[model samples]
Target: MTDENNKIRVLLVDDHPLVLDGIRSRLEDDPEIAIVGEAGNGEEALQIATQRKPDIVLMDINMPVLNGIEAAEKFAELLPDIRLLMLTMHDSREYITKVLKAGAKGYILKDVSSSEMLIAIKAVYQGKTYYSSGVTDILVNESSKKEVPLTDREKTILQLLAEGNSNKHVARELDISVRTVETHRRNIKRKLEVKTSAGLVKYAIENGIVEL
Candidate 1:
């Protein structure tokens, strides 16, 4: 716990300057939460986290030098005590699943209300997991029965596809051949009963693989 005078320190990590300003503005009013530092990318976030040891880290997912999921895994290994809350426009199942597996304490969309964002931050700081309404709905949907039980690899491909990744991009990320990626894509479509990429994306959204 923070000292009586010391508020819960928070580190904001995002690539957009406007977003950083907006989030800082929304959070600065709360006396209980202190905006300790700001970082533009995951690398910077990790550096600031190491130096500041803030109570909560508001992290963005897609970044230039290092993506949020990769950095989050590193942070989990390096700073096990720190709390990480994803604050990004992306609400994909792959994004959520990877980050949570990397040890994030909460997942919230960038569009969330300031009130809900604050609640998520507080919950994570208190060592509890919190997900925004849309994210929670995804988790619930994932737990229920499904017609197509996708393999782990197929789900990964579907997630990348839903995130707007091309076959080449997915292959590179997973360190697989383009031919292998195409094969998996075909298999995924066949199993899910979706023919087009657009249809796959729609299925991903409707079935909680990605958020609309």
Candidate 2:
């Protein structure tokens, strides 16, 4: 009963076949969604995504040969237009931060109901970000404690640093000079009240800024 013109093309990427089947079955009930393809691993997922170019990809965290984090990073580079919605069982801050930094538009737990999944997909497709209710408290608490709020650019720099990217690399990627990167690094450390790079990374990982 789906309308061909209105349906949102989707691609499923998870290592577990049963997980793919369950998600496909749940989504097929919606008239606005269409499962265009599926992949059991990140490599296969990348292939399907490149060929089918789905509007959304429901990615899982743990997978063989290029986990969801790596796949998402590549996908963002190759298919900038395709939005990624992470659908995984893990809600750990490390997993959440890593995937988001990899360019995912949303994150939702596997325990999410069918309706919630649909809402997440629609929100990401519309260029908005979504996070499950259980994880919202972590974000809220972190946001509220900021005596020194970071700018978007600052956050980007911090995220890159937490990913273990070198200052030179961060500068090149962000189109800033090494001196500037260092300055931002220092400012970020001071603002977060952290003394070392390890401390910064730890905070970022715990706060969902970087993956585990």
lDDT of 2 by residue, 1-212 (tens): 45655789999999888888899999988888989999988889889988988999999989999899999889888888899899998877778767766778778999999999999999878765667786555544544343336778888998888765779999999898999999999999888887655456556645667543
TM-score for each predicted model, relative to the true structure? 0.66, 0.69
Per-residue CA lDDT of model 1 for 1-212, tens digit only, reads: 24524788999999999999999998988878899899999999989889988999999999889888888888887997888899999877777776766777778999999999999898778765667999867765765445557988888888887665778988999999999999999998788776555456545655667653
lDDT (C-alpha) at residue 167 in model 1: 85
Error of 2 at 125 (Å): 0.6
lDDT of 2 at 152: 85
Q: Over all chains combined, what TM-score does candidate 2 have?
A: 0.69
Q: How close is candidate 1 to the true structure, as a TM-score?
A: 0.66
Clashing pairs in 2: 98-211
